[model samples]
Target: MKIKFLLMIGLFTGSIIYAQDSLDTRPDRARIIGFSPAKNTKNVNGMLIKYYDEIDHEIKPKKVNGVGLGCNGLGIFFPALLLVSIPSIDNWAINDIGGEPLPDKMNKINGMQLSIINMEPTITNGLEVNVSSNISAPSVTNGVAVSPLYNFHHTTNGMAISTFANVSKKCRGIQISLFNVCKDSRGIQIGFWNENEKRKFPLINWNFKNKKS
Candidate 1:
């Protein structure tokens, strides 16, 4: 059973990578430094910067291999609003979105992302730090995601730390926050209120296998 489960997991990840690899055609370019609405650039090996007004989600997503910074000029009001919501907004989002959000537009990051708020979907493999109300994945693959608000990911194979809430449609790692939910949990959840495929718990929750299957 364990072997079968592992094989299924491997196949699932393989499929996602294979599908995304199709985006790397001849037009993809690599740059030392890049800016948002990255045009034809497919990879950024140094600094990648973005401004609030320059985003066009229709543009092809770039792969940032180093550092990313954006949403620089929101003054204090935007942050204050997000901070005020706290656990309430995070909880509301969880119930409203059901599981995790669909990633209509996405960028791939392999290092660090620091932003006031995430403007688009992301597949992050390193550190992600933000002041936004929620950070949903394409999935936080193998790193840490830190936010002052909420985090909801399609898959969680990394650590998620948030002040308000953390959730994953499918999980294989840890979540630390005020509220934590995992649709199909295979790891640990540490929070005030926790929910998983197995049960609803408080303070901590965990599920290692799908017994029903």
Candidate 2:
């Protein structure tokens, strides 16, 4: 009984020491795969199922380098949708990539983002699949975004595909949807109604020249 008690005490002491050390380290350890609230200070390199809204781990910088499945955040960029309504001003002036400093949250996902409706003001460099809608404007998506309703973002360097609409401040690849809009486009827009800084067309629109749009 005395040996067992000693062993338990030793384990408790070790745990406290490790926790203290982790607070000072660059996240001494991480949760490889788990479902928890987004309050972890450690960076996640595997799958993370965020049950609650993402929060900033002010103690240290955090990132999710793998798959991220999140809700509770529909994005604070609803006003960016005004890019379509307000056509008089240049879209880049109000909201552009690197315009605002990123929040100290889980503001980046380097892999697949599975969103039932996830729209965080973060940069996503991989595939973003939204079951409903992804309205992460004034942010950036560097890969492909496949959505059912719409994909509205600040900048898309690859492709944006949606059934209803695809809107962006700047597009360098392609936008294919029922209604497509780009403030500055360097590629093609194929849809029923396409509009860019250059012109608006019915079937297709392309802007491959040096003209600034």
Candidate 3:
């Protein structure tokens, strides 16, 4: 019958060229383009072009339920942005860029991240605000990390604030600081110098193991 209508138009032109080669190999969904400053173009998602290496090489966007503005999310690779940074140091060389760090993967950032100066990230679950430093990675933040000077982390579950320092190696929750260190603390440390190799308190420190209910 005319060779089955030329084999059904060659299977509909090979399914429209395999659906345009699967949408050009998927991964691009954030577009608001207008400002251009060079063009390196990769896979960008939402609100494009505003300096910073032309949207920082654009590749992050495995998921971003909503909102993302940037000056430094450190050349994102993956983190599901809800990111907002606008006070640059341009990520402070971000793990020493251009040789070993080019979105060298390992960004979590579930939601809420506001930065004005520094907000390093290797992992973040929710809420991380910075004015100076809120560095992470070694263990990384789970939730809530605020900063005025420093709130470095190696492992923190929740709550870590800093006016001066709130370093951590392992803290379950809460560590407000004028200098609060931790090698291992279960919870609570609000102070003008509260350390914990096991327990050292000048203002307040806790191991907190009360669970009988």
Candidate 4:
């Protein structure tokens, strides 16, 4: 009976080892596969021109500044999205490569380019900032450009601000704003890179309070 029990244990151990080996030998899941990350290069160009033309048309004696702010805001959002989505992409890359290490160049997303035309920020009470970034403007190659976000964080009076910009030559201006307000005995925190992982620090934190809203 003891010999039979030992044989069963050995078989179970062998099965577990084989299962682990099979998983190890499996191919990785896909993350990114293409020439570039942007969606439709030509369309991106068209969008840029369209945005620029609209802004130029809307330019008047009174709304010139407004046009600029609109452009800046557009610029900021594009990059923010890219940066925020990188981790997911990396995970896919790992899976696709079957746990094989990524190439030095492809390990981290790079070659991100951006151009901002007529970006202006309007600050209110030093705590709030209004901005615009042009997404489409004319490019050197006469095509539209797509930019990526790197890092940005701002805070005032316990309020926190995060920004993402989409700067391209064709549109000549567009941006997105992420504003976090903290008031009434509240506060805020900001983090970056690996700081957000490992349960360390949050990228952005805040508390809001009733004010002159």
Q: Which is superior by lDDT, 2 or 4?
A: 2
List per-prediction Cα lDDT, in the order shown.
0.69, 0.67, 0.53, 0.25
Better of 2 and 3 by lDDT: 2
Give the alpha carbon lDDT tens digit for every residue of 5-46 in model 2.
Answer: 999999996676456444545453555553444333456777
Highest TM-score, which number? 1
lDDT of 3 by residue, 1-213 (tens): 999999999999667645543444443433322122222222333322323322223423232222222354453422212124322332222223212222444334456545543232345577766554433334266888887666666678999987866767678989987767776678889886677655566778888774346
Which residue pairs in candidate 1 collide? Answer: none
Q: Please give each candidate's TM-score.
A: 0.71, 0.66, 0.29, 0.20
- Ranked by TM-score, the better of candidates 1 and 3 is 1
Summarize candidate 4's per-residue lDDT along 62-87 as a digit string, tens digits: 11111111233355565455556644
> How many clashing pairs does model 4 include?
50
Tens digit of lDDT per residue, candidate 1, span 11-57? Answer: 99667644444454443556665667544456788767777523434
Candidate 2 regions with alpha-carbon error over 4 angstroms? 1-28, 34-37, 54-61, 73-106
The candidate scoring highest on lDDT is 1
TM-score of 4: 0.20
Sort by TM-score, best first: what order? 1, 2, 3, 4
lDDT of 1 at 144: 87
How well does model 4 score by local distance difference test?
A: 0.25
Report lDDT (Cα) of residue 158, candidate 4.
22
| After superposition, candidate 4 runs with Cα above 4 Å error | 1-68, 73-151, 161-213
lDDT of 2: 0.67
The TM-score obtained by model 1 is 0.71
